[model samples]
Target: MTITETSDGSITIVALCGTIDSSTAPELHKSPAIADTLRSVVIDLEKVDFLDSSGLGALVGTLRLKQEAKAAVLLSCMNPRVRKVFDITGTVKLFHIFDDTSAAVEYAATHNEG
Candidate 1:
């Protein structure tokens, strides 16, 4: 999987491409932007082709970390397949999801408390 990151104010945007399964989940966890609990984060999944349980776990873990730090973590541009996983698992309610990356970034920048 490919991960690209950018920053705006206190928000960091992480864009992911390729499959996010067990193999790639660790990389997601190790990402500098994702690991930084002090900054708000927007995870852009526009290019992600597939996601499995491990991927979901990584996302949830990130959310938990951010919550502990009082930092915001949102998701953006999730495709139908990825959305379905969150829906079926009832994980959608746990995150603020946006159809647009820019919107997510804007929201994160404003909502960030850390």
Candidate 2:
């Protein structure tokens, strides 16, 4: 998978591309873009076409870490495939999900007080 980032004030938009499975989950978990727990993050899954259990785990792990740091870690632009995984796994409610990246960024900026 490919991960690219852009910053909007203290909020970082992490745009992910390609597939995210066991092979890429670890790399995604350790990605520097979302590693900074002090800053709120918006994970853009617009380009992610496939997502498996491991990929979901990686995202959950990120959410946990950000929660520990008292920062926001939101998800946005989830395609139908990715959204289905979250829905089937009953994990969609765990995150602040959005249909638009800008909305996610706006939410993150306002919520990232830590």
Candidate 3:
């Protein structure tokens, strides 16, 4: 997977492409910039084709770390298959999920403003 980050002060948007699995999840989870400076993280998954247990675990782990830092994490643009995996694993309610990047960014902006 490839991760590209864009930050506008308080929120950081991380656009992800390709599959997120056991091999790629570690790199994503260990991003120092994202782990440290981001008050909120928006993960854009529009180009993701697949995800496994490790991928979901990575997201959950990141969310937990963000929460520990008193921040938030949002997920966006999940395909039907990925969404189904989240639903099946009952992680859907654990995250702030959106249908598109704009909505996730908007949510982050609004939350930051508040």
lDDT of 2 by residue, 9-112 (tens): 87889999999999999988667767887668899999999999999999999888888899888899999999999999999889989999998888887775
User: Which regions of candidate 2 fall more than 4 Å away from where they truly are?
Assistant: 112-114
Clashes of each: 0, 0, 0
Show model 1 residue runs off by greater than 4 Å.
Answer: none
Give each model's whole-structure lDDT.
0.89, 0.88, 0.83
Candidate 2 positional error at 36, Å:
1.5
Candidate 2, residue 14: lDDT:
92
What TM-score would each prediction reach against the true structure?
0.95, 0.94, 0.89
Model 1, 2-114: lDDT tens digits are 99988876788999999999988999977898888876889999889999999999999999998999998899999998999999999998999999989988887777544
User: What is the C-alpha lDDT profile of model 3 across 8-81, one tens digit per residue?
Assistant: 65678888899999999988866655667346888888888999999999889888877777677899988898
Ten contiguous residues minimizing lDDT sum, candidate 1 = 105-114
Best by lDDT: 1
Compared with the true structure, model 1 gives a TM-score of: 0.95
Superposing all C-alpha atoms, what RMSD in Å does each candidate have to the true structure?
Answer: 1.3, 1.3, 2.2
